[model samples]
Target: MESPGRLPYRRLMIYLDRLGYLLGLEGVALLRAFREDGSDRAFVEARIAEIRRLLDTPALAEAGGVTAEPGAVSMAEVYAAWAPHYDAGGNQMIDSEQPVVRSILDGLPVGVALDAACGTGRHTAYLAELGHQVIGIDRSPDMLAHARARLPGASLLEADLHRLPLPDDAVDTVVCALALVHVPDLARALAEFARVLRPGGHLVISDPHLLSAYLAPRKERTSADGRPALVADHHRPLSDYLAAALPLGFQVRRCAEPRRPALPLVAGTRPPESLPPHGAWDIMYWCPEAANAAMENTPVAVVWHFQLS
Candidate 1:
């Protein structure tokens, strides 16, 4: 039996095998020019060799070395664990999404602003600085604590996005960043945003791009029973966002898909001995060429600027 905190060896092996397959697919599709003679024969040969190496790798065959958390946990627990380092963590999604969301915010006429699911008050602080009467709402108390410390005078509330505590036409702007993916029904949250927004109000939202989530590492957290678990992440296609918003009288003003910059090849060198092949980046080191080809120029996040019609 596998130990409490470790994923089973068979499961880990399956992950490694899939990684190899991903690399092989990328080589055929995107890295064809790099393959020998750029021929179909060369691509098949390369893939076969890589598959052999993966099947024979001794480290991947062994049991109990993998320490990745398994199973899904609630968002509250996930953010509770993430609250302390959320702002400081080098989150690529935040890095890509923030500037675009802020640029939209900068153009809007500032008034009563609501930062729904405002983890750590990152955007709340910006709205306050922009001279708006800002209200930051988040369900996680731990996250709210950080926001309170960051903006002492800001009205910070612990609430869910499906039901905003504000009255009708309460705010002129609503900024929700990197939080909608956790909610199951996009329409409900968008409806609440519309409810509290005045006519002609703006709603700016940012979500981790659907394509990026396929390659990105899943967030891990400890469950109530102390077992390792994955944080819940729901994927909403771009069309779903539009379907949810348009019916609610939201007009699409602007949309930006910020692409991830290409990364240098790291296939020749092994990953650090101290770091095991658990997460996406670590596993990518096992086949860096494929990782680069698969991820290059992919959109990191989708930012939307919508005005209530």
Candidate 2:
């Protein structure tokens, strides 16, 4: 009795596309009418009820996470509030990036090193452990508070990456990770890093890949009061970094672009393996299908190593 344009098969194909986009099993079970499988509608209903119950439970983080009133906040304020949960959340970058930085720094010389735009001193602490005089710099006082707590002995400063306070030739190495994506003027920041480093010093940077920018990347976190907060990031092509750094006396020595690891499958979704070999399956966002088709084979994060010339 249905019209040909609105036939079940055509409608089902469209639903399948939307269903698999960054959703978990609980989301699939909520739309009870779409259970074409006919295998077990009761199981679907039971799972949805269980999910609802779990959502009703109170979380301790909700009590302490949000502190400000219901209003807009700056990125600095967001990090200030997010410091408590910074390392505890689903940040896939910290895990994927540390190894890359460690691998590049393994055989390189270590002297006075700057953790440019250091957040919470994670890399700063690691650099100090490796026998470098580590100086951590960030613009946020609240973020610096957490960094200071973790690295009392290391010199921590409240400063902006755009204008590093140190004198020229002050350090032998600088590690700027995952922070460049937020900078509007990459050239100025790169110049500042170069200005402080002694000639031949190493500069390592890790940033979100350009594809994420093309797809419009956003950072989401819970405010101190448990409200959703979003931060925007700017993405530039990896080549742009190389171009901006070269004229500033940085000689590119190494580069790595690593894609995210595969994620778990959700209900009613085609197994990831069923997609075309080049189609993306790990990006945890919803981009237009055409964009996915074009970028599925590209990496999602980029790390670069440069030596000051």
Candidate 3:
């Protein structure tokens, strides 16, 4: 049972999380205050200052901790070089998928969480901040390099998603963020995650929606040095994903086809016809004729949350 103010604090947190998104960096201090136990005003204020300081400062990563070994092929090589800049770059996935995933995760039990295919620890860091014991795994050493720096206390492993190193029924939650598209056969990965989750453990997955895949040029990406790399992107329709998982004794709790966020228009770029003229305009169309046409028909990403029966 919670105390007098605890229930109110918890309820306030739900509203505040959404508030944080709309407010950005400025909301951090206010949100930080709510994380306190009523008794600790000084501790909360100090932590807020620390967060503000860390947000502005550049990390001084040591040589060994930051280096990513180059891969033999273009598929691997692209991610290897891009690993350092992956978190720093303008990523639509983080902006679009994360908020939806984070909101779903809010209602789930916080315990041991497996960050399957955790690239650069985006979800890993969030799960930790939510008070979960996080174990982050990825095949890319380059991405793992950044993840290691981001989460020093959490266990970060370099491993294939098809064969997770953890024991069966080990984790309480499994979070696979935007990585399922790369695996052609999700059976192996899904089976492995099921094997590792205790009964009733929750699984949260986010991927580029199959509908958008056919409509957009999102699967392939070029590296920093102009080397073209095309990663394998399997189109698993919603029916296919649900079909595969239901047989594993999992029941769907929630699902979302989250729309792409309306980003601030680039300077000198004309606003799209869809965007209403405003004091501060937001637009989704990079190339209004092409991008907007595809975006209008389908969601940016597919997300799911399920609990094992």
Candidate 4:
């Protein structure tokens, strides 16, 4: 006779939800008993095994491909065509991460700052409110327009991250959020960031870790109009990103994996001026260069931060 209210039951309920199973009250009580009796691990593992079995079932195997429906527009076209919608969506996402943004900006020195790939100027307005002289840039005029409308006083420029229009060693701090994955050439963009940052400047980059995405279960995948979730061009493995940044003279300062809604934030700084340039090398030399080449032709969004040294 096991008690109905237990931790195992709660764990089981969560597992079932994760597996797309609708559990009744009796099922939940049973799980609770298992948890209270110290059998929670065993029961949870069994549930996971069952889900794996379902994933590999013959009926599911017969479905040749898990392709979403067709006739969907490209990500860039979606952004360009629906700039207002895009801005609204971006603002919504940013609002959810306000705490993280605040944490990143906490105690940061106030001065000239660049919000590279400043989509809809969410972070741009955040930086300006802190009294930093901010300059925001984006490839999409529509996005810039929306950003300008939001932050009327802040300077907005239409430019590419891979080749910024700014002069050498101009900004003291650069903050980029959720923008790097869209860039076609991450290495080139990083190099540009480093070139523009002054000595001892700060660079903060926040994006989803590609390794996490790859490891995440397929069931967690998102869909837009029954289409596979669209990500930016340079989305790549975490290892590739680290290698790209390290060689470019960035010394990682902090790495945070937020729990709520689960996101990865990797913050790093440019090496001191005393350090020699990592030297220019072809980004195409890295793994998946062919894939990157194909994406270079496609329009995508990306953001990054670099401090000149």
Candidate 5:
């Protein structure tokens, strides 16, 4: 039997193969590569070569190919494992999202600010530096502990974004950064943001871009009972945001989708023997050329600035 977190090699191989096809590799095109009399001899040869490698590689045949699929853990559970190194590790989504978010924040007049789902008080600290009286709220105690240490003087509460612990028309600015993708629905959290903001108060949000989320593999974790589980990360299309916000009387001030920084093509080298394929950037080892071609310059995150009207 497969171990709880051990994914099948076939699944991993299929994923890479699909990515290769999407990137115009592996004889996917009818006339150029798949046809017997096709002109692109190199393309046909490359696809056959890849197929043989996929079938025979020791790494692909190994017991745990990728982390196990699609199970879910609570936000609290997800952050419990991540809190210690949340800021230590670099995140591409955050890298692309922060500058746009800050640029929007910089233009807005600062006042009382609420940082909803404010993990580690990252933006809360920024809001404070901008002279806003900031209150930070998050659901995960593990993340809140880090936030408390980072902003000793600020009001930090254990709360959910769906039910922010603030009164109507309470603040002039609300910032929720890199948290909405974990939310099952954007409506309730957005409604909460709308409720707490005074008329014309600014709301800034940044989420993992839907395309980025779709392309990335689901994060794997262990459930409390030792079953395979996935960290909850949902892909909400850009239209979903508009539908939710427009109903709540928000006017779009600005929206930005920031592309990931370009990645250099990787050599045909294997990943470290110690790490799982799911380990950060390790899966690229399977088919580095196609991975590079498919992922380079893809949008990593979406940032929005809205004003309650």
Candidate 6:
């Protein structure tokens, strides 16, 4: 057997690994909990309690468990259930795009651009104002409807990002803001992004960091009438995001962590009937600008951008 003095160190290392694993499962479980009933306060509280317990256990120091908390749901289910509310007041999350757009325009050559997951056209209209032909693509018709109304002149297409309708190397810039987290297969989505970008074109992407997923730092909430509300998810790490950009022939131009608003910018211009009593707020945006700029000089941010090889 190992010496008693070394036992604590060995146990501590085991505990740390277990804690990491538990946290990862908790991330997935949290996604499920929100989906089952976004407004289910009891359910969410129970999950929080369970996750806390797991984090506190002594054995967790030796080996972590990756079990889902009771009554957890999937991320896709959560998005689909929240789709209507998302379209109505969800633009608040996209408001983080203001800074992202500013960063991209400051560096990229103005031309045709695509808002890969345009949501409600928050960035679509802004890109148009920048004098670039903008095309917004989303999988939800309701989302596209709101996007179209907001950006009537800009082209809005209802399609999934994994399988885009655009030809390879057709656009000057591609902006994927806050959409990668929901994608089941992040690698596939990044491939699609590479496939559509023109040689030497620019691509900007933003998403929550994996570490942020565990340190939520806020109390979970529910509707007064008890409806499930959605929170953010970070399916992949910063390293994965960077790796996806390479091998597709795109060079890392700028990698910076862009800041986001404290609360999600609520969409005020939606039909009242489809709106939620309280909007989903507090989504983060990452603004990574990659160009064929030879990877030598790139503007980088703290919270949002990550430079790729």
Which residue runs does candidate 1 get wrong by more than 4 Å? Answer: 1-48, 63-71, 226-228, 274-277
Candidate 1 lDDT by residue in tens digits, 1-309: 467997763344212233444445455434444543533665456556765675676554542332333334578877787899998967778988889998999999979999999999999999999999999999999999999999987799999998899999999999999999888779999999999999999999999899887766443445677755565566778999999999999999999999987666665667545434344456566656656656767899999999999
Candidate 4 overall lDDT versus native: 0.55
> Which candidate gets the maximum lDDT versus the true structure?
1
Better TM-score candidate (3, 4): 3
Q: In TM-score terms, which candidate is top?
A: 1
What C-alpha lDDT does candidate 2 achieve relative to the native structure?
0.67
User: For model 6, what is the C-alpha lDDT against the true structure?
Assistant: 0.55
Across residues 1-309, which tens digit of lDDT does each residue of candidate 5 receive?
245786742233222232332233222332332434533666546556765775576655553333443434577887888899999857777778888998998988979999999998888999899999999999999999999999997899998888888899999999999899878768988999999999999999998887676556544566677855566556788999999999999999999999976565464666456534343456555655545544556788899999999
- Provide C-alpha RMSD values for all models, in order: 6.1, 13.5, 19.2, 18.4, 6.7, 15.2
Q: Per-residue alpha-carbon lDDT of model 3 for 14-58, expressed as tens digits?
A: 111211221232233344346533425664454456446434433
Candidate 6: misplaced stretches above 4 Å? Answer: 1-97, 217-234, 259-309
What is the overall TM-score of model 1 with all chains considered together? 0.83
Clash count for candidate 5 is 1
Specify the poorest-scoring 10-residue window by lDDT in model 1: 9-18
Instruction: For residues 149-173, write the lDDT of model 6, one tens digit per residue.
Output: 7777678887888899999878877
* lDDT per model vs. reference: 0.78, 0.67, 0.67, 0.55, 0.74, 0.55
Q: In model 3, where do residues sit more than 4 Å from their true spots?
A: 1-74, 218-229, 261-287
Model 6, position 188: C-alpha lDDT score = 87
Q: What is candidate 2's lDDT per residue for 1-309, written digit by digit as tens?
A: 245776442122111122222233344334323544442666556555644543453431122222222223356877777788886856766766778988887767879999998998888888888889899999878878888989886799988889999999999989998898878689999999999999999999999888645432233344556655434445788778978999998998999987655433343333233222111334322222222332333466799999998
Q: Between 1 and 2, whose TM-score is larger?
A: 1
